[model samples]
Target: MKWFFKILALSLILQSFQFSDTNESPDLITSAQLETKKLEIQNYINSFSCSESGGCNYIAFGSKPCGGPKTFLVFSNSVNLVHLQEMVKNYNEMDNLHNIQTNAISDCSVPLPPTEIKCVNGICTIIN
Candidate 1:
């Protein structure tokens, strides 16, 4: 009987913290949005001209790229797409690169472009 009461109390506590999901849309990235994001990235790359004997490293918390520190131009052939999505799982319910939705307002400004963006490598990249 003690165990039963303990279980009931725990259940009630958990239920009190639960929130309704109605009237909210999932903020997952769609194919069309992804394509749009890609185009935006390409445009940023062109504007910065990072490929023409210029090298820059971009950080993507999820698939979205966030610009890190910049250095002098150097020769580099390929762009690195490091998937830091797992590292960003804690922010899954927040906006930007992780692309999740919740009632919580973001404390950090990870610009969700196409929603919000910032200059990375002298180019604008979506915050994720």
Candidate 2:
């Protein structure tokens, strides 16, 4: 009877170890989802047209694991600049959070911002 009780206790302990907290938060965004968001933002930026260099502009985009933007995105003033800025800001914040959660590592190299943005064939292009 003592042996039976010992075995039961061992089984119970092992069963407890099998259980885990699988309740992941719904707000958690995965890398794949972030990529999708990026593509969407790029498509939106591409929708705008520019006829003059003065209408072209650039915004720092994406967060590096070590801090700073991963790159810059060129856009035209024909876009809703305020809305685009908000979207990019949110994206950067989300990306930063993802890096923290995943313990991401990077080369820690800082990306240089564009020297100028120019309208080329109705599209905003980055000039470095």
Candidate 3:
């Protein structure tokens, strides 16, 4: 009958909509995942130890929307420098992608690099 055909057509249209492609991508990183990555990097950095001021160093971290790093993180030679740098590099890249995807805004103020890095009580600390 006409009514049965109309119902069938409506069901097919609804099924098509249910299976339609969306804007979301499987590879897209969510804000929560990004935050978790940041925290993991911070915790890794915090675990570093040093016995001498000479062993302390700093690296730029995070991407600002305008340009440059959002901040600098101080670490010590006691940690695996290459591994830490690689982790930070990956984090920076992820953050940059996140900023682009979110259309992030920023004040455009560049964070100043640390004047000095020193070992304080076995931890690397930024000195002004």
Candidate 4:
């Protein structure tokens, strides 16, 4: 009975060490959230620049989405096979990057507190 009590006490002590304080906060932000914020800021800056550059034509694809390579339509210049191949490769890369940026949120360590910081114009607003 005495030995059993000692074992139970030992287990409880180890368990206490394993658990962390509930009040403590995490220091990192999920990469997906960070990337999403970054993209938003980039889109905002690009729109400003586009406006300053005498405006540009913005196309809206209703039902269909913009595509590359295979379905590329040759307007005036005849599309080169090599160029098409390169476009396909670039499209794949962009797709992969999009997937990475869209993946489920996971914790990542950052230099500053994630909550207080916001990405503005591809830079952290808290620091600057």
Candidate 5:
């Protein structure tokens, strides 16, 4: 009984230690950061999807709906295979980053605080 109580108390102490009140909030991303994020999103779309045979056009941008790629990036007749491959890689990286970051920032931490914070232009406004 004594050992069990000691273990429970230690667990609670450890848990509370994990929660720290930050004196300063995390720096909100700047306008440049937002633009960069948008560009990354676009680049990710362009990269992940590629063209197929028979001059198939398969672009992976905005890939959520899984639309087919287009015939040509440039108006020229032939295609750029090397560029497509690089785009595919870039898309994969961006897709992964977006997913992870989005998941982390979605909703809020546990215990469900009654307040909410909305952010825009690197500023956060708390709302009831």
Candidate 6:
């Protein structure tokens, strides 16, 4: 029985890796695009839905806009799809790579995008 359990565990581990999928990488941000993305996020902060959580983890150029020495906003509301995409774009520019985990998010009714994304810890999952 012990040997059976060990083999089962080993197989499970191997199978986990076998089905793992990676997301698509976006075009690297240009100096112009980076500046523009920053304004987009800044303008987005005052908007509804996206700014409800105050601000999501986002980067501008190389600056850590959220979760930095100075946080941009408080966790207020659930950030929507558009905002999520923008956040991922900035993350890539700043090299803020996310370690993908299983899809356990309750509100993530939408299918996961084939792109890298960051999550809100135990809450919303980044499906970029």
What TM-score would every model get versus the actual structure?
A: 0.28, 0.77, 0.76, 0.22, 0.28, 0.28
For model 5, residues 22-121, the per-residue Cα lDDT tens digits are 7866444343554475475445433432222222233333112122221112211133656655755555455445445454232332232324333323
All models: lDDT? Answer: 0.40, 0.89, 0.85, 0.37, 0.41, 0.43
lDDT of 4 by residue, 1-128 (tens): 99999999999999888767898863434546445654543344343322212322221111111222112121111223354445444444444444454452323322222233333443333322
* Cα error, candidate 2, residue 60 (Å): 0.7
Candidate 5 ranges with C-alpha deviation above 4 Å: 1-54, 62-77, 104-128
lDDT of 1: 0.40
Which has the greatest lDDT?
A: 2
Task: Supply every candidate's count of residue pairs whose N, Cα or C atoms clash at under 3 angstroms.
Answer: 4, 0, 0, 0, 7, 5
lDDT, candidate 5, equals 0.41
* Candidate 5: residue pairs that collide: 45-61, 47-87, 47-88, 57-69, 57-70, 58-69, 59-69
List the lowest-lDDT window of 10 residues for candidate 3: 18-27
Model 3, 1-128: lDDT tens digits are 99999999999998887564787674666788878988888888788678884488889999998979999988877778898899999988888888888899999999999998778898888877
Q: What is the lDDT of residue 74 in candidate 1?
A: 19
Of the two candidates 2 and 4, the one with more favorable TM-score, higher being better, is 2
* Candidate 2 local lDDT, 1-128, one digit each (tens): 99999999999999888655789554776999899989989999988888884588889999999999999998888888889999999999999999888889999999888897788899888876
What does candidate 6's lDDT look like per residue over 51-116, in tens digits? 324433433233332322212232225546466556646544443322122111233233322243
Model 3 whole-model lDDT (C-alpha atoms): 0.85
Q: By the lDDT metric, which is better: model 1 or model 4?
A: 1
TM for candidate 6 is 0.28
